[model samples]
Target: MRITEVEIHEFDYEVARTGTVGGNWVYDPDSTLEPPGFVLTIRTADGTEGHYRGFAFTPPMIAQVTMVAEEHLLGRDPLERRGIWQDCWRALRHTDHFGLGAIDVALWDLAGRHYGESVSGLLGGYRDTLPTYASTMFVDDSGGLDGPDAFADYAETCLDRGYDGFKFHGHPDVRPDVDIAICEALAERVGDEMALMIDSSSLYRTYADALRVGRALDDLEFFWYEDPMHDGGVSERTTKQLATTLDTPMLGLEHVRTGPYGTVDSLAGESTDLVRASAHMDGGITGALKTADAAEAFGTDVELLLGGPAHMHLMSALRNSSFFEHGLLNPESTWILNQGFEGEPESIDDDGRMAVPDGAGLGVEIDWAFVERRRTGHTLID
Candidate 1:
């Protein structure tokens, strides 16, 4: 069946609090706060529709999705995902590929619905459940996760909750000594029972600083050290040096622009011990899978970067990847994104594992009533 219509819905959902590190958004210091959400709906001639929700949506991104859907997607078979993705990629070559990713995932959702199987099954399911780690939000002045002792206490809480792993997103202004203290505290607290990791988020200003932190992690036998320095995770030379200097394996390339090619190049350069792939950032599931295959070929593991159904599907299919990241978590507030989904698959169970929904498509049930209540604007392509 051919796609007959495409609808873009924009809405706002309140977040409990804003997370800041060094006077900026913790994720991207330069970027503005993102709009709540953008939901894309692709309709077929037979009345079946595919839906996908995107994070950090902006006006330009919504416009790009609209243009791509109207220009290259409408009237094409939804099942021709690869062709559509390629065409959209070429059309938007001068722009960010997030729009292409949004449409591509929607198409996959449609295909899953058509086949009456979950997206993971469509991608060749390997397992129904995945071990998950609680990825914490950046440190704040608030008493919640402010210091090393606080962080250790939080790790104990997570361990009690059945998490097998805990990853800390430290404050941006934190120094090497403080970083080392946090690492040591965590290792002393729960390191034996749980796999511990640290994501500097590229806050360290020098190789020496990163090396210091890396050496501490090595002493503690941490799982991985990520985005260690201010090079923003792009410099193959710096990453290679850091990997060589430290015993802890480096996980890099989360911010790299090119999809599978970038991952393969970093692997070939021996810059990273483990690679990172996000369905949202890596050109959707297609790009993520390509990177995964590349990592598999090199005998390296590709860690899925974020939590979501799409991410869950990719992690479930790939054997090399280890744990699902339940991220930006905070003690003061919940991590709920929207009230639209009937089931929240991202929530970790008592075993610290997340299960993939077995229903058709992404297996997510959207609450249209909630969407309509929250919607601020809409666009339709026919």
Candidate 2:
């Protein structure tokens, strides 16, 4: 069936138990925020529709989505994802392809529904449950991810709760010393028990700082060091030097949003040990799979970055992926973007593996009531 119409439903959601500190989402236990949320939906003439809400949404992205959907999506074949992706890429050539993923994801969800299959199944999935890492929030002074002991204590709790891997997001603004302390603590506390990693979030303003933290991670035998420098993860030269010098594997390119094409430049430079892709930023599942194929051809692993229900499906179909990135999670709350889903966004079993949603399409139900109840505004293309 042909695609008939596209829509963006915007709503307002409260961010509970989360707030920013030091330019990072910190443990503000009493924090509550009302932020606008957007969901992209694509419909076919057959009354089949697919929905998406998992990406890191912003106003500029919403603008781009509007442009791409209006310019390329209406009246196209929903199943002709590759063509749409390419055309949208050309459309967003001036931007970072920000809106392509949301559109493509909705289209994939639509296709999966039309065919009576899950997105993972649509992607030729082999695994049903994927292992996960407890990706922590940036170091906060608010006692949530505050210090070495606090971090170590949290690691112990996460391990007890069945996470087999842990990733640290140190000071949003970068404090190498503090970060080193916490990484070392987690290593000593439970590194032998679970894989450990650190994502500096491109906050290390100086090469020396990134080097220092990388060295500490090496000593701890950590699993990976992610986006260590303030280069927005695009500089091949800087990353090549760090990857060569560090014993710890480097994971980079999350901030680089050129879809699968960016993976080629980074891989060719041998700039990172692990590549990063997301259905959110990488032109949706189509782009992410292209990235995974590119990384596989180069004999490297592609780690799916950030939160989404779409991620489980993507990861399940991936053989070269490491772990399902569960959270920038704290003790008190889960993902704010999971508001209108059937269950929470990421469902972890007792074995620390995330379950692929078992139904058709993206395999998750949307709480349309919630969307309609808190409706803010919408854009529709017919």
Candidate 3:
């Protein structure tokens, strides 16, 4: 079927907080926060519509979506996913092409609906459930995860909840010694019962700092060391050096572009022991699958970043990958975004495994009323 129209809806959602300690999208220390979310609907002439939601949209990202919808996606066949993906890739080659991913994802959702299947099934379903880890929020000084003992206590709570693994989103102060102390404390608390990992979020300022922290992780027998030093995990030589220096596997390239091509280059350079794939960041499902397959070819696992319906599908299908990240989680905040769902809002089972939605497409049924109430603006291209 051919596409007849595209609609973009921008909305605001209240978040407990609006900044990340490090990695991509780190907010300024004093920046005023007005977080934005968007939903794009591609409606076909025959009345088949594909819907996709994107969180944390910048002004440029919103503009890119509008441009792509008006110029490239208005009348194309929704079934021509690969061709559409390639066209969008070329259309915005000069830029990182952030908005292309949302459109590509919506197209995949449409494809799944048209075929009466789930996206995971379309991508070759491997499993129905995935073990998940408790990925914590950045350490705060506000009496919530403020210190090492607090983190260890939280780890114990997660273990009691049935999580097989836990990951710390360390403090943003770039203190390697503090990070090491936290790691050691966590190991002492629940290392025997849970596999632990850490995402420094690129906080460490120097190779020496990262090396020192890496050695501590090696001693604690942590699962992986992620985005350890600065340079935003983009320096192949430096990452390679870190990987060679540490026994703990380095998971890098979470912020790189070009999906599989960039991942393959890093692999060839021996920069990372493992690769990272995110459907949202890596050109939607198409690019993420390419990265996963490339990682497979190299005899390594691809840890898909973030948590969502799309990530659950990828994790279910990929054999090399392990543990879904139930992230940015904290005691005071709720991760639930959508309301009026039948099962648990977060998609996590009582056994600590993430369950794939069995419904068609992404398998998520949105509460349109809730979304409409939150709408700040809308744009329609016909």
Candidate 4:
């Protein structure tokens, strides 16, 4: 089917209470500005349409992307999805193409709809139900020290609901001490009954700091350490520290871009464990698949991060794919209003597993009413 129209939807929700911290490494908010959420809609000539969502962006950015892509996509074949992904990415390299991940997701969904197949099948189907883990970010007003208690509460809730594993945001300012405490408490609370992971979000500030945190988590038998340091320069250093200093595996590459592969090669030099591939951020299915292959050459395993349901489809099918990052707080209320599966922790299986959408093309249905209700200004393109 050919693309008849493309529409971009931007929405906002009143910030009720900001309990969780920002995913960005450097975060300092005086409690004034609210975060934005963006979602996109693409319609094909045959009357089939697809929807995809993303977090932490402004309406102007979403509008800017829609303006650039509407011209490129409108008379093209919706089935030619990979080509659509490449062209859009190549054209937007000079202007923060990372923000364009939502478009890549929309294109994949479009192709799935046109071919009447699940996105997972296209990604090379492996299993229907992929085990998932809870990643928690709840913190009390005390800043960071309250994390351990909040984590304990959250973990227990997930466990009660049937989840097998859970992860917590481990960082310094958020309570470096609390990070240690939570890992220790979690190990004690669940023991081998659940798998545990810690995401530092590169909050350690220095490589040495990351090393200390990694060692602590390793002692606690934590699964992996995420983004201990954001800079590529220290990636190998940090990975080596984790491998040697601590047995904890380093998991990241979520915000990584496609490039010379030098950093990835260095990290895999008996230092790193898994390269976290975010299909949304790293281009799309085609680009992500390429990244996965490159990691294989270096003997680094690919652990895909499912930012949401759309990515979950691909992660379920990926052979080398590991687990997904499930957001605890609704960064963007409108982003998931219409998609299947409520944001409730229970949507994930008791064993922390997810079943691939069995129906055609991502197996997700859009709730236009929800979309229209949240629409800020632009109309849903027919």
Q: What lDDT would each prediction earn against the true structure?
A: 0.82, 0.85, 0.80, 0.62
Per-prediction TM-score to the true structure, in the order listed: 0.94, 0.97, 0.93, 0.82
- Candidate 3 lDDT trough over 10 residues, lowest sum: 23-32
Q: Top model by TM-score, which number?
A: 2
Each model's backbone clash number: 0, 1, 0, 6
What ranking emerges by lDDT with the best candidate at the front? 2, 1, 3, 4
Model 2: per-residue Cα lDDT over 1-382, one tens digit each: 7777887888878767778865567777778766777788888888889998843655766899878776698778888999999999898999888888888899889888888999888888999888888988778777577889988998999899899899888887567999999998999999899999988889999899999899988888999999988988888889899999989999989888877787898888788888999888778888999999999999999999876878889888888998999887877655564787766747678887888887889888888888898888888888
- Candidate 3: where are CA atoms >4 Å away? 17-34, 336-345
Report lDDT (Cα) of residue 335, candidate 3: 43
TM-score of 4: 0.82
lDDT of 1: 0.82
Which candidate tops lDDT? 2
Which of 2 and 3 is ahead in lDDT?
A: 2
Query: What would the per-residue lDDT of candidate 1 be over residues 5-123, giving only the tens digit for each residue?
Result: 99988876544555556643343323334246768899999988888787653465677787777779888999999888789877877776767767877888889999998899999
How does residue 55 of candidate 4 score in lDDT?
54
User: Residue 177 deviation, candidate 1, in Å?
Assistant: 2.6
TM-score, candidate 2, is 0.97
Model 3 C-alpha lDDT per residue in residues 69-135, reported as the tens digit of each score: 7668878999898898888877877777777778888888888899999988998888888899998
**C-alpha displacement of 235 in model 2, angstroms?**
1.8
lDDT for model 4, please. 0.62
Q: Which ten residues in a row have the lowest lDDT in candidate 4?
A: 329-338
